[model samples]
Target: MTLTLAIVGRPNVGKSTLFNRLVGKRLALVDDQPGVTRDLREGEARLGDLRFTVIDTAGLEEATDESLEGRMRKLTERAVDMADVCLFIVDARTGLAPADRVFAEILRRRASHVILAANKAEGAAADAGVIEAWELGLGEPLRISAEHGEGMTDLYAALMPFADAAEAKTAETAPVTDVAVDEDGEAPALPGNDKPLQVAVVGRPNAGKSTLINKILGEDRLLTGPEAGITRDAISLQIDWAGTPMRIFDTAGMRKKAKVQEKLEKMSVSDGLRAVKFAEVVVVLLDAAIPFEQQDLRIADLAEREGRAVVVAINKWDLEDEKSVKLKALREAFEHLLPQLRGAPLVTVSAKTGRGLDRLQAAILKAHDVWNRRVSTARLNRWLTGMVEAHPPPAPQGKRIKLRYMTQAKTRPPGFVVMCSHPEKMPESYNRYLVNGLREAFDMPGTPIRLTLRSQSDKNPYKGRKKPGPSKLRKHLK
Candidate 1:
């Protein structure tokens, strides 16, 4: 098991900055605003030779139980419980505030191991605040600057012992390769470990993307409000639902290209696009009141073009009055507008009321399975023969076009290669026909299918020519 460290602090103490530095990526959003991080985000961290799992948590705050800040504090406390070590951070430039002391006491009581870090200690001006951190009574304060990358060597030393012990323990109990044989004198296949399924939720502004995620987690782990564009960064969280581990990404809502004029919005959109590319399954959430708009269609088309498993989710369904009529209309619009994602799962969900979430989860898993589906070469060729017999290829320029063989080249958006006599002469309509046939025959829906055409005549034309002519001429000259 890897060592887990949690960075806990009050609002805007550069906890996220430190996390981004350790993870070697700008995964967590950084701004001048406080409380930007509202959930616990985990990443693989490396500092010199130390490797561990680092968590960036929401700032601890004092508030009533029903308020948003209170909810955020609860989430942060959960992170503390899950961590093997807690790095309690304080702003060295501003000294220790009351909230910092309160959180420090909380960590001292709850966590078994704690490291005191006085951040923003890059300048001489922060010397007094660093000294003040000593008053917390948790050992020596490691004076460091997360943003400037200072004093990391000392931090590495503090964490190295724990990492080494964890590694040694893992080595001692490692699984053995030797196994018992069965009655037939054959070894049984070892059980495979399943990785967490990666899913990204994306949609237009104010489409309840964040709300849906919070509902799934059964907590207000993500910040939500009535205003548009409240989520400026793509935040990922790991959750286990019905015994399956899932890493879900909550992304900023994307607007039309023409409407996105601000620089910040552009960056947010780009971040969301990156999340989509990294995700194995993408749920395109739509507003129930105005579902399948032009922008919605464009977003779904983008997922298809990226060759990702797609699931269309209609959110805020609790607000819709005409359920039957609206569902009928949405289904029709889905087929008409996004024909490329034909037969994909369309699920209705209410993020606020937590309705129909089970169906949505099922659809997402089903889509992922379809995305990773593979067809054997023998079955693929047999299917291809049937397809060609059903509808012959169109021969351009009066030349006969023959599709010689077909085989699946890869899975995960299921790619295939078709060898033919005149590949260049194959029309786009025929390609679509074959792709559609593959989807239907293989029970693959809403997952991208790739079909590549290769010409058999691409081989060398003059392979058997003898080299005797040049030798005969040389001999005559001699």
Candidate 2:
């Protein structure tokens, strides 16, 4: 088992910078703004020869109630309890505050192993604050600059004993690998091939994306309040749901581009877009009372354009007065307004009560399976023959347009290419016909499909013969 380390501190103490440095990548968002990270993010950290799982938690606040800040503090405390070693960081520029001391007391009682570090200890200006950090009664404070990469050797020395202990315990408890005396030698123990699927949940502000994830986790794993835009960073978590392993990303609420004026919020929106590109299935959560807003349609359309399988989820279903009537209306609006996603699954779920989650899971699995569905070349050609025979291509300017053959070039939002004559003259209406026919005949619904038309004359016909020099050209001309 790998050792786990948690970085805890008050707001704006460079905890995330240190996490990015240790992990050698900026996986967690870092900003001059305080309380930017509201969730616990875990990454594999490497310091010298030591390897461990490091968690970057939210800035520790004094509130312990149901407010947003209070919920953030509770989530940080949960990280402190789960980590094997707690690295308590303090700002060296601005001496120890009262909140830092309070957090020190909390970590002292909760965490098994604690290492005190004074960040921003690069110049003489931070000397006094480094000295003040020792007054918290957590032993000597290692003066280090997480931004400048100073004093890492001392931090490594402080954590070596814990790493050693964890390795020793793991050796004693871990099962030995089976060995074969034959030539194969049991093939050793390779890594497991069952990696988790990637999924992203996105929607407008206050759409209850975080609440839905918390319900799935069976705990308050994400920070959620009655405020709009509570989540900022795209936080990903690995979990096993209904016997399938998946890595689900809970993205920040995306409002209109006009409303996104702040630089921080712009960065947050960009991060959410990146998550959508990397995800296999994107769930567009919409409030039941205000379903099919303009921004909601835009978000879902963006997913389809990116060639990702989409699942439209209507949240806050428990607040509805007439369930059947509202559901019928929603289906009608979905089909009429967003014809591009005609067959996408529209599921109603109550994040507050966890109702209809099983249906949501089923929809997700079905969408993913369809997204990866493949069609054989022979079958695709047969379907193409029937489609072309049913509705023949148009004759533009007395020129016949014949589609010769069709074959699927790829899966995962299946892409197909067709060999056809007079490809440029093929109208968009005819292309749509073939695309819709493919979706119906191949049983692939809602997932984006790419259709390409190519003519045999489309290829370049360049000659490799060299050009004659000036004298030879003159003789040939004469």
Candidate 3:
């Protein structure tokens, strides 16, 4: 509950500018133009060692009921609701406007804590408008110029109490001690551990998802029941297994919307989606009794679509009759059902007995390591050359598809861009072939491999250059 301070105002009142000043970075898009910032942006703010969550909201404006701006206004209202304190800003140079009055009324009703700020108050010219801000009945206005960086000390002093209060609240709510021992049974060191690698455990209801996490932690921290949809919010636990730090997120059993009833359940679905977005690795849990169902496939496909490193965990493996046969059948079904996540780590585990927790942890860490692995440009080009040599690109329209150069653009799903003579004309089959080759070469079999083809003809400098630019001394200077 770090105090969330939202900087909100009408268009072109220097809200984003003030945000950049407070956050000490140009995170929000800043321009003289009005309504340049449409989305609500969040950043960590620090003023003299005091920390708080700062939010930059969209410019509030008058809107008709059916207009696009009206929808944007609704979004802004939601941002206001999320904030603990609202920094209501007004333009000190332009004086108070009707829109500012409207926003003041909104904040008066909504915000528990409000700080009235008169921005652009650097000189005597803005003095009149700074006084005008008091007419809104929201106490003394903070006179400051966000662009010129004036009057920040006063702002910091005003925000100190809220920051301290939030810190106290956080200390009260956080668990006293939530640490899991390593395999060697030593008290795990706290606070200085590795950054939490977000891992989402998602599956249908009654898939032993919570039980699996409890086994890993060696405690009954998460509630375990046979009932579906027991866990509403996506609860997260910071766990250390074998010296590796991981943030395990236990998501609710996501069901089809048609079957969902309560509003809380809908929010639970949204929570699951949020967890997926936050996660770097997603472990799609499956019941050994009913493996590779349509819902299970959907969950795994969603992880692949999100470009997350995926591992399929078949839970309750200890209870399965003909365990070896079931495991083999499930593996075949997994490969056949979701080819997009081919070779994904499918490990059997008993959440009740902790049969395969070690294997699960190992697979998760391996997937995470591979997800962050970046292939060198030289290695990528060599792999591409070998791929091309093994099976040449298809000839379409009697022209050989010329793939000139290939380079990895980014990792974390291992995206590569192939600069080619004709990108659109390159066959889809060829793209799939190259993707498979990349997976095999890079040892990134299960993760999604992105292969993009860019037509390099226009990118060649020779095509865009004029024969000669004005100066004859240009060549001599070179």
Candidate 4:
């Protein structure tokens, strides 16, 4: 019963900017160019006391019925229809235009409730557009500077009605608790038995990774003395933060090969890589002073390739000023910096002060849930059928590669095994397409998605009409 809000507008109307603002993270990609955001991105949003789900949709444009732009528009409209409320954003600096009016008409005809926002309204230059928004006839415009986070309180006030209703519905329908309880209601909590979210804190040397772990644990459990490479062992500790159980792994720091002269440092580096493989969710800790080093992207790519849920935590945020400035910049950098893991979770936290520890843990849990998610056979086939219609698989070597069926093989990393006519002959790019579709359909981003092609055959070796072996014939001849 999560409340859903859809942000819709033409391109460069600050939809992503407002999306990032509401979600309190740089989760969506933001740029000055139009159409930078292609998909409908959803995240948990918080505004003042209101918390709900928000979907940032692609810019709407009129195009040919079956063109890509039209498809993108259809996706946005679909989101609008599904949402409890819609936030129609218009650039306050530019005032209303024909394109904005067209989008308004579309939403007016379909969307149930629309909240208008005049974004980028920081100074006098935006005053006129704020007044102009009244013409849209949705309601009084809430002048907001999404980049600077202005007028969010007023926005929150407007959202409380929807949020409260959604929350009430959730409370009424949610199942009774007591995951550990039985019929008798007498159950002892076992030692280290709580469902703790498994998180691996990893990064390069002196990225303040160990220090972050120490702060989260609220003690020197990791033996942090400021000297690099002090923590060689990948120690796992169970702790509770805000009533949430977490299994935290503090690994040895990694360093570049050119600088590693000590034999012990080399082992520590190898140990860190091994720890990454072992984690259910990996938090790639980065130093705020120097963000996204080449090795950092490599490690993140490795985790993604290995099919692990990834959350990038930019540590040392307490030292930065105009924090939003840096957060916005870092996110823009990450889009191009780690395109392989595009849409991966990126969080800025002062692990030193535990500023964003709760959100970080929540993001980790979400990524893990997505990683372990499995779609039912009926729903999967339905989705697959639609996908094949949208984009049919190509013919390889004069034969159409028939993907007969698909089923989730296992969970940990959420692997899918597809039974097909010729798995070996399936193109690698086609495999990637299936993987990407699985990720988008399941809403799993920042986690490695595994799609394995498999051929179905009889289990028995002599299932068909096989007769006696050559050995039996030779025995008769002897």
**Structural similarity to truth (TM-score) of each candidate:** 0.81, 0.92, 0.61, 0.55
Model 3: how far residue 477 lies from native, Å: 6.1
Order of all candidates by lDDT, from best down to worst?
Answer: 2, 1, 3, 4
Off by over 4 Å in 2: 175-194, 458-478
Which residue pairs in candidate 2 collide? Answer: none
Q: Is candidate 1 or candidate 4 better by TM-score?
A: 1
lDDT of 3 by residue, 323-359 (tens): 8888788878988999888888999999988898889
Better of 1 and 2 by TM-score: 2
Tens digits of per-residue lDDT, candidate 1, 244-363, equal 789899899999999999776787898899999999999999999888888999899999999999999999899989999999999998888888999999999999999999999999
> Which clashing pairs does model 1 show?
none
**Clashes within 3 Å, all models in order:** 0, 0, 0, 0
**Model 1 vs. true fold: TM:** 0.81
Q: Model 4 compared with the native: what TM-score?
A: 0.55
Q: Pick the candidate with the highest lDDT.
A: 2
Q: In terms of TM-score, which candidate is strongest?
A: 2
- Evaluate candidate 1 by giving its C-alpha RMSD to the native, one decimal: 4.8
Which parts of model 4 are misplaced by more than 4 Å? Answer: 1-195, 225-227, 456-478
Q: Local error of candidate 1 at 306, Å?
A: 1.3
